[model samples]
Target chain A: MSDPADPEAAPLSATHPDQPRDFVAPGADRDFAGERLTVDPAGARALLDARLIAAHAAGDTARLVTLYAEAGDSSEAAGDAAAAAFYRTHAYVFALQSGDSRAEELHRWLLREGREE
Target chain B: MTVTDSDLAAVSAPVEQARGLPNACYTDPAHFAREADAVFFASWAGLAFAADAPEPGDVKPVRFLGQPLLLARDREGVLRVFLNVCRHRGMILVEEAARLPRAIRCPYHSWCYELDGRLRTTPHVGGPGTNRHAAIDRAQLGLVEVRSHVWMGVVWVNLDGKAPEFETYAADLRARWAAFDRPLAFAPDGAFELEVACNWKLAVENYCESYHLPWVHPGLNSYSRLEDHYNIEAPGTHSGQGTRAYRPMLAEDGRRFPVIAGLDAQWEEGAEYVALYPNVLLGVHKDHAFAILLCPQGPERTVERIAIGYFDTAVLGEDWAPMRARNAAMWKEVFEEDIFVVEGMQKGRHAGGFDGGRFSPVMDSPTHCFHAWVAERLRQPA
Candidate 1:
């Protein structure tokens, strides 16, 4: 099992072999890049995106799925069709890993030619 | 089973010859107060669903017979009814329907009570002792309990403190429909609450007869003929009619709920609609059952709280949103169709020339049975 805190950890396999080694790992330190950047909307978005990338690299599939779904919603809200489609694909992968048939069905419907923007 | 001479004399004068309970009985302020004491408060009136108070510490507040009543499932999982008012200062203890509070605290003075209606704490009252009296016993200051019984998922409370045992009163109904005693779940979409501008009895009367099915409910008449319906009357106890052509809701695979053991094929086609004495009306079909509690807001206004419970709770978790919407639409249509008749009867009762109208003997026996029951109750000395 991969350590969720280690960004360089191995990707999760199809079979859930055992519980994660660092299942009860200690909390990490919080660091701010800049005072002005902390409050800026664009900075907050980039920070969230970086966190998702870290979560995905650490093999946190549940968090990855939720982040992807949130990203898809934001992209659709901002009229970014290509970005929305990419995030939706990521969400579909995570949903499959999470064993959610309902989400998988919705993802299948969204991937159809007529549904794509 | 014998009618006394007084009982015979009371009912011997035909409904036409005898003056019906006056318009005041349906629409006056003082009369409403009197009926609250004589009828509504005296009898075991249906108040809430048993499922509403399913677990220990589950408490639901209801306004019944113009008084706030709290229905609670105690530590032993026994349902108990109590006046919602605090014993200390008469403040309402619980105002909401669903709460699992460790203690019911009065918002006014913080007098706390246990889930079982025992007074738990009267903070600072006895300690300071500057003005407190020794007669103030916390044990005796428990919330006033009202007599309550749960049958077929309905919670009935007798507010007068003394009434016949619920089992004795409802024994005939129990024997008549004994097979429907399985675990039932409320159908989220099939249940509704309706406010009608009519007396509560008027709603009961309208439900007792099937003569208006063709004219009022054309959709139902298309499926069930008038001849296929029959009145079920247990003399002075309860009255309802049953239909033989009930079609069950089909699953996506056309499967129906398994019928109870010992029930014949006739029960599959059978649907019993019963008005349990004063306020509750229940409709039991093979696949589903629904009940309505006709709560009297005033003489001319009644709130009909209706709920449709299913045979299986698991079915509700399966495609619930769509199935609920479908059932809601169907019930909304049928109940909407009943509004005109109930409201019209209320208006008709006010006419100077109108006597308590005649019964068709064959077609109107159900309604006559209901009228006779009401007349007997009214004639009894309170």
Candidate 2:
């Protein structure tokens, strides 16, 4: 289903926990149970951003880290490099909070951008 | 770097007592990167043909030596090459070859640039639909331009922007073939590409001499004898061989293409093959001409972009398809014949005993001339 909050973002593919799908995380999460699944990636930003907000509200650090990373990649691919870097910063924080191994990966990226000491 | 000053110095030494450039010259990534600066970027490297963007508003994205380049034609009908990177966030502006309507709009932020490469508008740079910004300098943020020149239907780019003018750099070859200083149209079925499992220099070395004609190209020797070939060695400019007994590559029906006007009596029976250093191999005859653009993929790989053109633009139409096909096939066969030998030479370069190998003092002068030219260029400080 489209994220009602940010209607301007690209449409994103939905994820169903029980449904086996392609490896497109940092995109859509396995926990998502969207009402209408999609293949179009035009307003994916709003949908993923909504997902990230919901994960944060639910205190789901694991989901937040992955969602934040996915948002960064989509933003980068869409040519909004500033937004991509911003999302990456959020991903790095959640990665540390969740004790995810991706924290190390994100840390290296932060180092590259001189974001982390 | 695997290539040292001593190895390159061997190029100018006495041929019988000298060694070819070390195998690392063709195998090491670092050495290749070094040449990318001193040789390829500093010289007039082939990028595209004017035929690729014949009309206004045509855009082609090109990657040369791993640098993104976008070729565009403006409304005024002037062709230009740009860095292909957007100024705001360094996004790739154009990723494909297509004709644009008026402007190049960035896919990410929707920032647009005019056909002439001016920063036209920023859809939402200020805010949502607000285009102005006190900090952003529109004029200075225009697309970075690249130094480019066109000659004989081929586009050449000097990334460093320090090389002499194309006319000055190519004066000797231009003066030699001045009769062919006319316009050329690319034949419709005249373009094709080949992937070779060999370093680019191997192809150049293989092309600079005709010593392998009798052995490797037995079919070519049937009509053109080994004795009929002579060397073209204009040091620092270009080097290759010329065939004295050249015959038109006619169709089976024996129809001949229109000859280029004002050709000297020599061209009536002569054809010259020259490697205009860095990466273009050219062939000139009385009726038609062709150029091979070499794209080096890695230490042991290369992609050849071949295009055949004619003095008569009519040769690009339907009636000339058969003749163009015949010419393409003939050249394709000849180029294919050298794949094994060139690939074999690339493999041999890995052997510890291959100390850049030796040059035959008599039959290898043109090839030596090429090596010497490359060494001289690389010898310059980057």
Q: At residue B160, what lDDT does model 2 achieve?
A: 94
DockQ of 1: 0.01
Q: Pick the candidate with the highest lDDT.
A: 2
> Which clashing pairs does model 2 show?
A9-A43, A10-A42, A10-A43, A10-A44, A11-A43, A11-A44, A26-A70
lDDT of 2 by residue, B1-382 (tens): 4677888898778778777878888888888898889889998889988888888888899888899998999878899889999898999998898777566877677567766788855544555324457777888989998888888888899999999998899999999989888888887588899999888999999998999999999998878999999999999979999998888977677889999777778999999999999789999999999899999888789999899999998888898888789889999999999999999999898898777878998889888888888899989987
Question: For each of the candidates, what fraction of the native contacts does it recover?
Answer: 0.00, 0.00
Off by over 4 Å in 2: A1-117
**TM-score for chain A in each prediction:** 0.55, 0.64
Error of 1 at B269 (Å): 1.0
How does each model score on TM-score? Answer: 0.71, 0.76
Candidate 1 differs from the real structure by a C-alpha RMSD in angstroms, to one decimal, of 16.5
Q: Encode model 1's per-residue lDDT on A33-99: one tens digit a residue.
A: 2222223546546755886888868867566655665565556556665565566555544554344
DockQ for the candidates, in order: 0.01, 0.02
Q: How good is the docking of model 2, by CAPRI class? A: incorrect
lDDT at residue B33 of model 2 (Cα atoms): 90
